[model samples]
Target: MNARLLILLPASLITAPALAQGGDSPLDPLFTCRDIADDGARLACLDAAVDALRSETESGEVVAVDREQIEAAEEATYGLTIPQFRLPGLSLPGGGEDAELAELESASASPQRVIVRDTNGQIESIEGLAVAEISENRSGDTIVRLANGQVWRQTDDTYVQLTRSRADTDYTATISNGALGSHFMRLDNGGRRFRVERVE
Candidate 1:
């Protein structure tokens, strides 16, 4: 899969002149709040900062997600070569640090039918071994830690009870996108499917 830059920084920060309390730029909120000696005043300053942050989010000037949402989204998108909003870098697949560097066979090919290959040759898919370690939270969500150092947590309310299939079983995580641009990761042979979000 090809990586695309999906930046969501506030456009005002990028294009507007520095904000000012007067003609000169005002102190940055984080920096200014740190200098407040009075506890109440410091808290009020911090509140203002939080209000600014919320306004940025509400105005669609910044892309923001809570920790829970992010954790869910991450688990669902593991193994997919997702676009990042950070720096300019190589287009890489979504996986843990132990992920193998695989290349897309053809960049000009069709979208969903992406073919990935390692140094050896073409690969079936991004593969991971289901380790003995697993857990289910009170919310009915699950987290699966693979042997390859990748941790996949089940997002949403979907529940997939695991089976002791094998002592050392390898699982396939296939990423497929819908026409509406939604992506789904399916664990092949794992009885149930989850709206998983990759957190690792």
Candidate 2:
């Protein structure tokens, strides 16, 4: 953005001069573009004068009169208060989805663990369990290991044992739990041996 263009846009938009009442020029109207060398030169001079006036108007030395405030003050002086014109509520036509999402994410609480029952009628104890490592296998199966040397794999509603040994030594094994909630042991049984269940 050009600096001159920015100044020009604001200057042109301002219908009434801030300091001068009724948009009156400080210089007399008689001393216009016609008084210059030629039409083009005269126009240029007029533009320069306008720019100078705008600059002067912007300076803090001049006290700019706000017409609205002036009128309100006058009304109060006369003991007749006029209701000021108010702009209606401004709203974006379309909803701000991104902004709303950002606000929701900011205000949202972090993930929390609630005590839930397991498939084997056992209360899945997550007490003092700080998640150490979480991984997903090639079969889209999620495995969770806690800080308390407890390893759990997503079996069904319950997290079943991926391995019996939880001595902090990582060992991969094949374990099975049926849809009937039956626990079985299968070593090197491949993927088909274990009956997979939804781990909601």
Candidate 3:
């Protein structure tokens, strides 16, 4: 994994909850490193407490805000931030290759396909497509293309055939099942449309 990805790993491992805290809330638990009779015992106790709290929060048995408060209490007592617990080797299932393959297969099987014709002389396919760009005509109909290569005249959510672009040329297209309840594009590009069900 990239070093930058490591930065997000810690944040993702630890949940951050927005909880209301004021004088009215109950006092937080404190773990004192100095309280132990010996140096080794004190360090071990502190480590154990922090690990236990982190595990509970990550498992959703305890919320993140409560954990934060606990850490705050420990910090106040010890004047040091406890080492946060993280699951080792956490990763997305199947990685990017599997995800791309799934997307292509879904698009190929979709009923609605959007085709694209680029200036180049190569052809590409897009499946599981959604609206990327819209150029308006005088008739108020929109020329919509997908991440895949299916193009159609869309009046509203429904699309109708206007003109088909030649496939021998370089272009990109996309198709989508639109089977998901809600519609959202990919976070990175905001163009690749994937159903929540398909993605999950």
Candidate 4:
């Protein structure tokens, strides 16, 4: 929200596509508001940028997502291992119970075993079918595209066992957190495991 960031918004938007492939983009709103000598002018510039983005979102030129959408994306991409989606309702590793999440129903060591039902709680295991597209990346990793329109990319460099897939066959992906914030993904019954990340 700083003035410097606001001034760079225009140029940053022009190069957004470059950021999609893991490249960095400076799309912060502060680009436009920066470099204004007067505090009032800088504030006005920031407000204008916010209003313009809001208008664009309303007009369908751009998408504006809320917390729920973010939660859904994390769920769809990485399973229930998201730390923020479910607040601190978990028991400490050594013992004593901490403050439970306001809406958390239960927390389990196995992410899939965990259950959260509050307004913001993580949903049950993400299970789906209809594997529409199954391809390998340049690194020889499987790229799965579900019929429901979710695209996942294999982050590890492991060759998939099956080269062909049937549309009617059911496929499931399990994602869990490793040490630190690292996330791992598994496909099918777990023959090939990869550090998968969501592409769409």
- Candidate number with greatest lDDT: 4
Give the candidates in order of lDDT, highest first.
4, 1, 2, 3
State the TM-score for model 1.
Answer: 0.33
Segments in model 3 whose C-alpha atoms lie over 4 Å from true places:
1-4, 7-38, 61-145, 148-200
Where model 1 places Cα greater than 4 Å from the true spot, the runs are 1-132, 168-170, 178-182
Note the Cα lDDT for every prediction shown.
0.44, 0.35, 0.34, 0.45
TM-score of each: 0.33, 0.22, 0.24, 0.37
lDDT of each residue in 140-180, candidate 4, tens digit only: 76787655454667776666555245342355555455455
Which prediction has the highest TM-score against the true structure?
A: 4
The candidates, ranked best first by TM-score, are: 4, 1, 3, 2
Tens-digit lDDT track of model 2 for 114-154: 32336643332212223445566776666644333334455
As for lDDT, the candidate ahead, 2 or 4, is 4
Looking at candidate 1, what is the lDDT of residue 140? Answer: 64
Stretches of candidate 2 above 4 Å error?
Answer: 1-31, 34-37, 62-67, 77-200
- For model 4 the local lDDT of residue 24 reads 27
Question: Each model's RMSD to truth, in Å?
Answer: 16.8, 26.1, 16.6, 15.7
